[model samples]
Target: MCLRGKQRAGRVQSRVHVDTVDPLSAVSDGVYRLDREWRFTYVNAAAAALLARRVEDMVGQRALDCFPEVAGTVIEAEYRAVFADGRDRVFTYFHAPQGRWFEIRAFADPDGLTAFIRDVDDHHRSDQRRADRVAQLTAVLEALPQATVLLDGDGRIVSANRRWTETGEVIRDAGLRPGVIGDSYLEVLSQHLTAEDRRIIGAGIGGLVTGGPRAADPPFVHDYAHAMGSQRAYFRLQAARVEPSGQVVVTHTDITERVRDQQALAWRAAHDDLTELPNRARLLELVGEALGRDPGRGALLLLGLDGFKAVNDSLGHEVGDELLRQVGARLREQVRPCDVVGRLGGDQFLVLARGCDAAEAAALAFRLRTALTRPFCAEGIPVPLTASIGVAAAQPGGDGVHQLLSDADTAAAAAKGAGRDQVHVFSPGLREAARWRLEVANRLRDGAVDELVVHYQPLVRVDTGEPEGVEALLRWQHPERGLLSPAAFLSVAEETGQLIPITRWLLGETTRQAAEWAAGGLPLRMSVNISARHFSAETLVHDVRVALHDSGLAPENLVLELTETSVAEDPTRAEDQLSLLQNSGVVVAIDDFGTGWSSLAQLLALPIGTLKIDRSLLTAAARLAAGGSGSVLTAIVSLARTIGIRSVAEGVETPAHLQMVREAGCELAQGYLLARPMPAADVPRWASRVRAAGGDSCALALRGRAH
Candidate 1:
């Protein structure tokens, strides 16, 4: 390492002025300061913290008093050497009280001397791992034909391989020396370097030179030439920035050949083996990144081939692949480079556009829609496919990756919701709703006991309409704003892993309530909605059983509701767990049916006795009945009947809604049209209303619906 032209003669040796500030104070790597009397003058935060003593208490404390055993031996010699040399010294020592080994950082100071100690007992393997990684990097760098060198911030050569030396290059500076005492990198550079190189190196000399703030995500690359190597070599510098030290340690690798390898690897990783465009992984990564960051008033659109499934089903995947390629090319050409274009596995694709005013995002979406609409002749057939695009945008600091993707997904569902070949941009109301949802998520993570509460909505038989079960719904009675529904908190619950404890709490309380109900002759079934994140663990089931057992209730009385996506993530585990519950006499229901990824085939195969038609569909069915069109209601009713699984409509809010259920042929309608979730103490009284006229049941349902 060397620096060339700088004069050191007149430069004040500030490094020697330790003053009242202990030398250890400047050394973060575990340092200690000793006085003239061989007593401790200072200890760095690291050393003080490690020794479990305050810096104030350690200062002026005699060595023997601090550690009686180190009186005249290794510790004494260690302190003396630092004072004598006036330079840094390293040594290893066993610290019995700490029960560990240490690598000490020692140097002389104005007061006397200072030392930094690090507990390296557990670092042997870590050091080896680092060494092995460095060796691997060296091998990789050496194989490249391009010259490479890693330059320290001081403009000294930190690492230079054979390729770097072979290239004709060097830096000359003012003063020069080899193994010179008190010499610095400036000494070497001053001896040999060009004028231009000197200016480039000296650009930051008068300013505080530190790496910029840490990048949230890493694997960033910096491209430049190694001053030691005159050849135009593209070196990729990977830096690990340690904020506390204000230092960025960079590893240089010759990337001329490696870039080709990188492209090859990227192609392999992000392209389909059969049809190479962008794989699901690449699409998700790009989309996830786009979605994750503050897109700054940008829009995200998820475009799916409207009739892709039909294409694959009718024609072979080969024809489908060709069709996909043509479609991909058109989509690629449809957007500007500023927008991210990616294929999200199968026929799913996404576009992320920044600075694209809403109108522009809409315009781009239309172009993509038109490009996709073109008919492609495949497998002796003209296969026509359109797209359903869902668009969502960030509002100020409103959107992160999760929310954007979700909104896009929801918007896409809206496009699909409104027939395909259309694009749907998320409405302001939806974004506001999402914002509220995020608020709930934050509350869930912070252990917001204030807002947390559980409400139970009663479930009844279809014909008898008797309250047979109670579905627990979580409500956040926010202080600033009134009560909020699970829709606000559920997504947050799923995201922050609060769902587990929340589910556990819900299960435990439901068990207690159910036991009380049974004891009081109500004996209603206790049902709880399950989140996808929770099913991965056996703990939830164990918790349910514990709650049941603790509450003196039978496991047979518990009913767990799972939406399609929840089961899809881990169907085998779900099946096994649901079997455990069902075999114990409990019931399992697939909630929010007709709204998720799974099909009727999976639905029938699943171990469930009930299916809750999504509220949108049920509401649509009910609306049709209210409008005197019995046709749609009748058909939905027929579908439910044909499936053999009991159909439950979740948002029945009126008498007409209930009547529609009876007319449509669905079994149960739970809503504000039914009894709302009530306190456990009020349940027995409410349960008495089975024969208490439909209005009583209706009142409770409205309360739940209101929530």
Candidate 2:
């Protein structure tokens, strides 16, 4: 087929001769043949489909004229050059008008030029997808908190994040600046890491790049601490192997705070918060360690402070805390360098002296007592202090820390009993004393009500010698021993918390006996001693009302006497309690009034009806009365009178004592002379006999003033 183009009206015209072999019509790829004039002489089916046109209409048309978009473009220029040099040209071009990529080959033929075209759009899209994937991965690495480094399979640094660049400069002084691309990271980092860190990191990196048997597990981690700027920082390095590509990625993260928190927790576990000394657990641990090292060369000393509770109650807990801190400091100063001082608890301390014998421990204890005896004046308040120290020598592989501490505690109790501010060595007798105390505490808890009884001591009128009232005293009838006084077992009862129930039983029993006496025509006022523990009880008012209701006794007939110390504890709270009792018609008396540090303001604030002079004060007043002074007693009585309270003098055994009470203007007297405390059963008979013999008034009330 021959196609010719003729010029007509400045436009190209084309003619075709369909006599030649049509080679372009047999191919699957697109085909079109154009003469020198650029007219289409033949167009195959594929080319027609590619151009979306008819073969008959394109056969005589000019190729550039048929598609004006490619008239002056590179695609058209290359096609013209193929006809000019008679050279075969192959090229790929994007047809923007059709939005497709085309690969074409132009061959110079004897009849005309032929061009072959194929669509290459899929290959172009695959290359664009690969570039997009690379950009996405780069963005993710840049946003991470940890400084990250990526290495190739050959162990050379291939890429790094922005954080890696910043950290590399900061840590460069430590010889760890290996962030540049195409550098050996392992070689650069070897100078900074220790031999052990080097080994761990080397194994991890080798496992990643060499693709060993660590493909299933997670990344390897390494931790180290380094000083950065002014503070030390901790970091963890994690080396992971990327999947499909045997490359290594290392990340560094700071963990300084986590490490510091762990250290602080460990320190707090072994120390006391108040004194900053080693606590009981830590002290025992240290003592056991010392004993283990030298079995017979160590001694333990335990100190119990006297009157610490009074300071805590009177001043304040804040002042009490400051006192304890000062005490700890003083203890540290008194001990040797090898010794350890620690607070066991409130008002109790323990010292473990290494290389010390009993004598040395005793000496140290004495020195400590002397040091503590000086008034602690912290917080600007002078507080007198004393310590009872107990020393126990190590038994050379015989006893543990617990036994040693327990023995020391027993000896300390003995020291306190012998009047505190002294030191005592552990002895066999102290153990027996401790055991007896334990037994007493247990028995008191079990059978306090059944084994205990109240005895009545009559209080007589100082003028007429008439029996006006009786004071109830607690006596324990032990099954083994004879009757026991309060001084024998009351301390143990209070220490073991058994005094509360015991006091309740006493109140109920005394009220019942007083009601019985009144029913039998022997009416007298009943005075019961109440402890500070009972007086401070929230149920104190309720307990008293219950007792009176249950015993059928009038409130006015019962008198509750409290010690001066008990009344001084939390005076405001004590006033509230005392007011409740007084409003119920119960008389409140301050027993042993002059023995405590009660201020005049405190005494006036408390709602009280009577004041009982202690035996010591009365004895002193009696001796002074012999000299015709009697000023102290007169002042006390006059104060009582001014405050609308009656005065009662205790321990009036001698005629001189009786004479002094009458001279001092005291209203009542109680002593062995008036009536020794007797059983509740014997009180009635004693009162009846004294009344029948007309001696009750003569025995109790003075017939006339002492001359």
> Compared with the true structure, what per-residue lDDT tens digits does model 1 show for residues 380-404?
6787888899887766666466667
Question: What is the C-alpha lDDT profile of model 2 across 1-707, one tens digit per residue?
Answer: 23334434322323333344556667889988888888876777788888877766687678877888897877888987887789999998888878988889999998669899887777866656644643555576688888877777898887788998887888776544545888887886665666887888788777778887765268788886655546677778888877655667788787788878977887788888899898899999999999899888888899999978988988999999999999999999989898999999999999999988889888888999999988988688899889999998888765698988899998888889888888999987887878888889888767756989889998888887778889999999988887999988888888888888888888899999999999998888999988888766666788889999999999999899999888787687778888999999999999997788889668867899989999999877767767887468988898888879999999877777877778878998898767789998888887876687575554533333232
In model 2, the runs with Cα more than 4 Å from the true position are 1-276, 289-297, 304-330, 369-389, 395-400, 411-429, 628-631, 695-707
Q: TM-score of model 2 relative to the true fold?
A: 0.58
Clashes of 1: 37
- The global Cα lDDT (0 to 1) of model 2 is 0.82
Worst 10 residues of 1 by lDDT: 172-181
TM-score per prediction, in order, is: 0.45, 0.58
Please name the candidate that would achieve the greatest lDDT relative to the true structure.
Answer: 2
